[model samples]
Target: MSQNDALHGDDLEKSGEALIEFIKSSNAESVLRGARGKLQEFFDHHIKTKKTTTDILNDLVHAEEGIGQKLVNLEGKKSQMMQEIEEIEQELQRNLSRSQILDSELEFLQKELERLRDAEQEIQTMQQEVDQDTTEVIPSAIYVAQLYCNVTKIKLELDTEPHILRGVYYGGDVAVPINMDTSTRSPCEVSDELWSLVNTEW
Candidate 1:
C-alpha cells in the first residue's frame, strides 16, 4: 500500500490486531520482529525502484521530443532543397532556349554570307568578260593616227617661223585636219571596233 493509505485508511485497525496477536502467541515475537525487518527492507527497495522507473520514463519522454524536433527540421530543409532544384531546372531550360535561338541566327547569317559570296563571284566574272571585249575593240591604226595629229599640231604652234609651213602640211589627219578651221575637211574615218569602244557602255 502507498504511504498515504497506510497513514489514513483502515490499515490502522489491521495493524492493531496484528500487534495483539504477536503478544499473545509464544515464539511469535522473534518471528514477527524478523518479518517486520524484512518488510521494511522490501518497502525501502520498492520505493527506490519506483523513483528510478519514474526518472527513466521522464528521460525517455524528453529524448522522444528531441527526436521529433530533429525530424521536423529535416523536413523543412528537404522542402527548401526541392525548391532550389526546381529553380535550377527552370534556369537550365531558359539557357537551352537561348542557345537554340542563337543557333538559328547563326544559320541565317551563314546563308546570307554564302549568297553574297556567290553574287560577288558572278560580278567578277562579268567584269572580266567586259574587259576582254574592250581590249579587242581599239585598232592600232586609229591610235597611231590620233597620236600623229596631236604631235603635228603641237610642233606647228611652237615653231617660230609660221610662214614656212603656211602652204605645206607635214603631219595631220588626212580626213579631219588638226586645225580648228575644219570647214573644208572630210569626215574622220575610224575602224568599226574603235567606234564601238567610244560609243558603247561596256
Candidate 2:
C-alpha cells in the first residue's frame, strides 16, 4: 500500500477502537456523546461525503435530548396518575362510611316498623270485642220487646182476643196485645264518678 493509504487505515482503526471504549464507559458528557455520533458520520463520510459528518452528529445529539425529555414527560404523567388513584381511593372510603351509617338507620327503622305492626294487630282484636258486646239482632218484635224488659227494669205482658172467622178463612183470627209499664229504670244515672272510672280503664 501507499504511505498515505496506510496512514488513513491506521487512523480509521484507532477511531473505531476509541468509539468502542466510549460506548463501554458509563460516563459520557453531552459533548462526548455527540463525538460518538460523529464517529459513525465520519465512517459514512469516508464512504460517501454527501453530507458533512458534523451536521449528522449534531442531529443525532438533538434526537437523544428529545428522547430524554420524553422520558421526563412520561415520569410526570405517571406521578399525576398515581395522585388521581389516591383521590379515588379516598372517595371510596367516604362512601363506605356513609353506607355503614345508612345500614344502621335502616336496621332501626325496621325494628320500629315491626313494633307498629304488632300494635295494629292488638288494636284490631280489641275493636272486635267491643263490636261483639254492643249490638245484637232479634228474630221478632216480641223478642226485641223482651230485651228491653231486662235492660229498663220493667215487665211487658201480651193480651190475646179470639174472633170466629166466616167461610172467608178457616181459622180463628186472634188480636195480639202488648202492655208497657209507665215507670222505667236504667242501671245508673249520668255521674262524674262513673265517667272517671270508665276513662281510666284500659
TM-score per candidate, in order? 0.45, 0.35
Where is model 1 more than 4 Å wrong at Cα?
A: 1-25, 122-202
Candidate 1, residues 1-202, lDDT tens digits: the string is: 9989877666778778888886777677888899999999999999999999999999999999999999999999999999999999999999999999999989977886786576567656655665577756647555444443333322223343532222223333332222333233333432232222221111
Query: Model 1 scores what on Cα lDDT?
Result: 0.62
Clashes of 2: 0
Q: Give the backbone clash total of model 1.
A: 0
Question: In candidate 2, which residue ranges exceed 4 Å CA deviation?
Answer: 1-53, 132-202
Worst 10 residues of 1 by lDDT: 193-202
Please give the lDDT score at residue 80 for candidate 1: 96
